[model samples]
Target: MSTSPTDSVLEGVLADLAAEGDLLETLVADLPEAGWRTPTPAAGWDVATQIAHLAWTDEAAVAAATDKTTWDALVTELIGTGEQGVDLAALAGGAVAPVDLLSRWRTARTDLAAALRAHPPGAKLSWFGPPMSATSMATARFMETWAHGLDVHAALGVEPEPTDRIRHVAHLGVRTRDFAFAVHGLDRPTEEFRVSLTAPSGDLWAWGPEDAAQTVTGAAYDFCLLVTQRIHRLDTSLVATGRDATTWLGIAQCFAGPPGEGRERR
Candidate 1:
């Protein structure tokens, strides 16, 4: 049986997702309890909370893939419950022992990979925002893992080894250009912006037309950091060539939910 293009694409995304998760695990595996309690740049979140949030979201992604009933219930419980405070699941998960929390994250991500691989091709799964194909969901997972890994690495006073894997994040950032405006209640741009990024491998990865009036050009790493809100606009090397394109850099977010309070200038 020949595999579909979607299947091949999903396999690539899954591989990158696992690698990103492993990178996070390697960073946290030997940390002492106090290290897990160290504050990251996410304001109130500690290192443990970052890991726990990844684990919880992985579990939720699995539920979204495999169980509609459970997914809907999760939506009801987690989606509109800012009234209960931010990320009840992360807070609860972060309260566990560091060892147990690590174990759970490992298990949840493993299960999530399997669930995504087994998901029906061409089917869209329910999510907090729009439904996503398995490939898109896995890519989103990679994006979050990389973003949260940034927090953990920062907390540990360590620099992450940058790789071409950040292309997944950069791709999402370019794709969410309109969402960035819409989320902030601004009108969507009437035209597509050309995005050109230099990947860690020194290769160019670009999107949109070669002749588009609006253009965003930068390093893929900085673009990923910007879109994830891991780095503030003022700190990145990204350059935008049009009015809305410049503004989009300020508000760009690849992830779902309300706009996040981004990082401060270094």
Candidate 2:
């Protein structure tokens, strides 16, 4: 991978996600017989279900990328099968063992990453909601993987740091900050805010105008966790300074479409 600004950030994210996936694989594979049955934060779903869901989603993403027949067909399948609060629930409800599901998931991520590297950056691709560049779609998938990894992190009581690339995923969330607010029927802020991430490498990832009206300061992992709604803002000492800063913190979204409810507590 080239070490240009964009490629560097993206590669960093890929490496971080890969490491997290390795941890996830080990955790699921080592689970006691009863561990697979332990309930995850996701409603009515256990660890097995979560792993299955990851496998299913990852495969669908890869299908959208490489298979001509699977282009829009898979998106239709997902929307048709999924219901509110359980988007992957219906797809993952199977008899497969947690280990099997995770193994498949590992393969899918590996394949997807390879596909992304092979395709040209500007290649158009089919995603769930909108058409996107291959690179953009890859970034979205990366965010999804990281977000779900946070769930496992929560369950395992481990705090995983983003080595450096979390800034890519975090930038995605920053881009959608307005969309997230609008999803909640709230007005997008007129004022811009600066977001600075102190990555585990001690390198800084900064977004927004340097002299913006508001600022959010924290470790990159905490910011990623907050924007993804994996961790409640109250759970960390992430600082959102300025009046508009608090407002932006209230709604930060990375995904497309209507904004999600996000976390209730600030």
189-241: candidate 2 lDDT, tens digit per residue: 88888988887688888888999868988887778877777666677667898
Q: How close to the true structure is residue 82 of candidate 2, measured as C-alpha lDDT?
A: 50
Candidate 1: C-alpha lDDT: 0.91
**What 10-residue stretch in candidate 1 is worst by lDDT?**
78-87
Question: TM-scores, in order shown?
Answer: 0.97, 0.82
lDDT of 1 at 19: 89
Q: Per-residue lDDT for 1-266 in model 1, tens only?
A: 99889999999999999988988899899999999999998877899999999998998899999988987887777646752434677778898999999999999999999999999899998887799999999999999999999999999999998999999999999889888899999999999889999999999999999999999998899999999999889899999999999999999999998898898889
TM value for model 2: 0.82
Clashes of 1: 0
Give candidate 2 misplaced runs (Cα > 4 Å).
1-13, 81-94, 158-162, 256-266
lDDT of every model, 2 decimals = 0.91, 0.69
Best by lDDT: 1
Model 2 lDDT, full chain set: 0.69
